[model samples]
Target: MEPVLPLVLPLRLRIRLAQGLWLVSWLLALASGLTLLCSGHLLVQLWHLGTFLAPSCPFSALPKVALAAGTLALGTGLVGAGASRASLDAARYPPWRAVLGPLLVAGTAGGGGLLVLALGLALGLPGSLAAGLEEGLGAALAHYKDTEVPGHCHAKRLMDELQLRHHCCGRHGYKDWFGVQWVSSRYLDPSDQDVVDQIQSNVEGLYLTDGVPFSCCNPHSPRPCLQSRLSDPHAHPLFDPRQPNLNLWAQGCHGVLLGHLQGLASMLGSMLAVTFPLQALVLVGLRYLQTALEAVGGVIDEEGETQGYLFPGGLKDMLRTAWLQGGAAHRPAPEEVPQEEAPPKEGLPEA
Candidate 1:
């Protein structure tokens, strides 16, 4: 058995193994490229899906179509490039020629495996996948607001509205002091009040109406109570101040966008996990094999030179050709080799 193990493989067996390895390598390269392409396409689709679903946003189908087309083109390019590179490399290096068949086969199989993994993860882990994205966006928004000055008028108005809409004022003629007719007329006669009285009344009214109690000022309150008759729900919906409709809408939108983002992230993460590390390992192995083959070729070339049968058509010739072309300007013109005078044949021992 030991002696038999050292026997050379039949030509048929050797050819089959070579074919298998080539197929595996080509498949791996193609699969890696296709996975990358699909990931990109999915990302674009996610964006277009988000925009399309947005309530107030205008939807254009062009982006979605473009994404699909781009992905298709990318996949085609990847497969083509992988096949071409494998073929070219195999032609250039004899050892790689053996492994190419197996590599192509294995690559195809691995890529198919990764595609299955990506699909499974996309189906299984969407929301959990997207949570970090939401948190990150929230943090970014907080940071941006902290660094930037309030720029828009609407922003200021929103801030003011948020602060002022829900508080209670004192019962006294708070309006008259501030020269507001509504509060002054409700409690005090403007005609009867002295200048000082009017001023006090208006200031009191403004303070009572504007000052929000800690309990009533809770921004999260769906409903807030104020210490005034005007705070009743029927009279002033603004008494609560918080916009439930807007909050609900915002929350719903956030949830939906988050789900989409999570779906995408999970799909991408799964693809990377399955495809990248495996592909990298395959590539490393291929490189090592390539180096080993080159070493063997070097030994072969040396042996061939000793035997006066060195093959001219090889990497050495190709490299020499390339070097000559690149250094054409620097290279000296070939000098003619002049034949030296032949020595006279000696007929006898030198005298």
Candidate 2:
């Protein structure tokens, strides 16, 4: 086997690696933070829709937004400190006094804390998969249909927007509202004789053939499907000649909304995939540079202080100093060292 290489790399290589890792980690962190904020915004919008029909307990995305902001702030501060430490001239400032130890400590605390929170969220997500979205929505819709007063205009607007944007019908389909008390209830479908017969029996107003909400119709459809109209008067033109029925979207808003949320989650997972490893690389590079710094010695020229050694006990010494300097919320008094009585001096009696 060839002779073993030194534990540390050359100064030039270390410097270059340190700079590259620091820059990459900082950029990745910044990008991740922005992505997380966007994801949180998507979640909050969905929550607004979910609580639209049923406003029992409001879902607020404040916590998610706050967490993202906190992470961004901490990452930015730590990266800055690490970069400052790395840039310090080895000849004038030792690694410890260059503040590398404190910076590393802060970095480790921030990174480890984020990792723990992520792990906790991942573990807890499975417990609230749907959180009664389907059941609660069905009940709320049923109650709304029965009540003629039009209780939740906000929710109705949200649903209309959702339907228009996603090209979907009701919660499941246009048929989900077939049993509603509205006059347009009869305009579900004429092809299904059973449904038609049911509507005819339950019809409170004039008998008209069927269609979906105006929002569900394609914008350029020959005949406008109006929200006020019980059914589109020109049904043949509403449908694309290729497919059956009115060419309206048959899927539900619930699934599409949930999918938006799931995409947010996936975005978060991808960010973590990039960030976790990038952070580890940054930490390792900083550590290597710090070690290299140790060997160079005597950063500051002092008569009494040890050359190249600002901290004598490594991290322990740094922590002690930080605590003494009021870094902690409550600083503890230093421990007292017991002293032994001295032996009798020449011609002098001992105490």
Candidate 3:
């Protein structure tokens, strides 16, 4: 078989191709970043929850890394687009060139980070991530406290956030709360004696809470179900072995949370597939633009017409010959002022 020849686009077509492509790429990049950020807010809560683990966790860091990577890429893309447009200013070329080094560095780092994330997702996420969460969540539950308990409030807040946001209960199910130390260790505050008294009275055995957290209650459940000894009406003040707990969340948080992450990973994979190609094309177009900038004489098209400013003709003789050596435009020469001719008149001898 014969070797395939490269598709060489005409100079005019190449220039035209770069022309509005930046905008398209930038929009796509922005969408990708925004999607990552959408998950970032919830990740903050998980980050707090991870602190309960002796060595923290993998899932905890994933979204944070995504946030940082997306931010860096988005920022770099915005700057690059601005620079591309500013290239036409002709006055800003030096600054643009100067900034190019940092942009390249940042873009490379962000791109590399995104590639790594995509690769990680492609390899699959179930086993390690789920295992980490499964183990770390147990540790987190041991320290659970719905109210203030120095250095642990974040955990409680996160637990509640998780249950409420996911509309589920506990790590594995509402019953998981039975094994946890639900009451805060902090000294009872007089400011809210009723809640404190309720907490103290509910304690059973060494340390116990039979009912799930208030966050465990379904939003549509009656107001009475919001408090404990959280009776299911039929089994007030006592857990009934025979009856179903209608007030409590029937689903567990672990699966819902894990499934959410899987969705994000899938989304990330799709976005990466689309984004990388657009970025590559944008970079290729920029390479051509780079050549045009260095040449400073406009590219010659297949029809023999110049596509940009050129010397001795195009755009004020290449903008007043300022870019003669690919540099800034030169200033116009000053006008000559005329002097009085009295001395010449006094010595008016014929030449």
Candidate 4:
């Protein structure tokens, strides 16, 4: 099969292609940076709730947030440098910059894409995640209380807030609070209970009656439920065997939180789908421009006519002709010239 011929694009067209590729890549990088920054802020707002659900979560800290922002900034800087070089000083533009810019963009996109894909995949397996959360979250909460003793007051406050806002209870249900050390331990504020009572009374006071906070009760109730019947007008209790239907909520926050995470994953996936192809297109267009530049350079000679190495056979044919001429110039003539008669007579007389 014949090899496909390289395109010989006009210089003006080549310049336009280069500029377009740069524009697309630059916009993609800039947009990705902004997306990451906004996502990080959102994560921070939701972080308090997320940690209550999964204490060991990696995104609980700010480094991962910083990483997302940093990668985007790096890619944008490299892309801008490459674009300026390509436009203002084409001859000085390093080929390495062409490669580096795409690599940075691809790396950022690929990493974030894979992270989102993994989150989506994990959440998609709701059965496994649900099973794990049932025992894992309960254990995490219990451990936090045991270590903190008396209670992890800050965590408890946050947990209560989360439960109220999301309409959830303990890990599995309101009953799970019974296992938490903070509620079960009798030595809450062992030293000078009367002295420390004023500041910590509201939180500690819940243990006076039941382990669960009023937040565990349904928010729709008219009054605070913990006071009596958790303010449920019908006075439905959580663990009453006969009143299962009147419970605050059967579903756990695990599912609700995971669903929100799934939305974030979808957002990242969409961004990846859009940016990855644009980055690839920029790389391919730059490569085409490079090839076209080389082709044009080879075709135009000193006399400005299409010359050596312009076509597949051009260089070889020129070399072959040169070889044949060199060989003929060194070869002996087919016919020999006769010697002069005087030279013959002089040779005889000497003999």
Comparing 1 with 3 on TM-score, the higher-scoring candidate is: 3
Indicate the worst ten consecutive residues by lDDT in candidate 4.
Answer: 300-309
Candidate 2 lDDT over residue span 242-324, tens digit each: 44345566687667655755566555555555556555566655655555555555231212311122223557656677787
**Model 4 compared with the native: what TM-score?**
0.54
TM-score of each: 0.32, 0.58, 0.58, 0.54
The stretch of ten residues in a row with the least summed lDDT in candidate 2 is 300-309
Give the winner by TM-score: 2 or 4.
2
After aligning candidate 2 to the native by TM-score, how far in Å is the CA of 245 from where it should be? Answer: 1.7
Query: What's the best-to-worst order under lDDT?
Result: 3, 2, 4, 1
CA lDDT of each candidate?
Answer: 0.39, 0.53, 0.58, 0.51
Q: Per-residue CA lDDT of candidate 1, range 194-253, in tens? A: 534645665454312322222223356474444233323565555442433211112222
Tens digit per residue, CA lDDT, model 4, 1-351: 221344545545555556676677676676556556545654665555554444444433332533454364436445643753464344555555446546544644664464354334433433333444555466556654443544454565666677778887767666565544444354556576653553355564443323465666776765444523332445544434344444365556666666665455456445544544554555455445444444444221212222111234445665787799999999977887787666444445655
How close is each model in CA RMSD to the real structure?
Answer: 17.0, 11.1, 15.1, 14.9
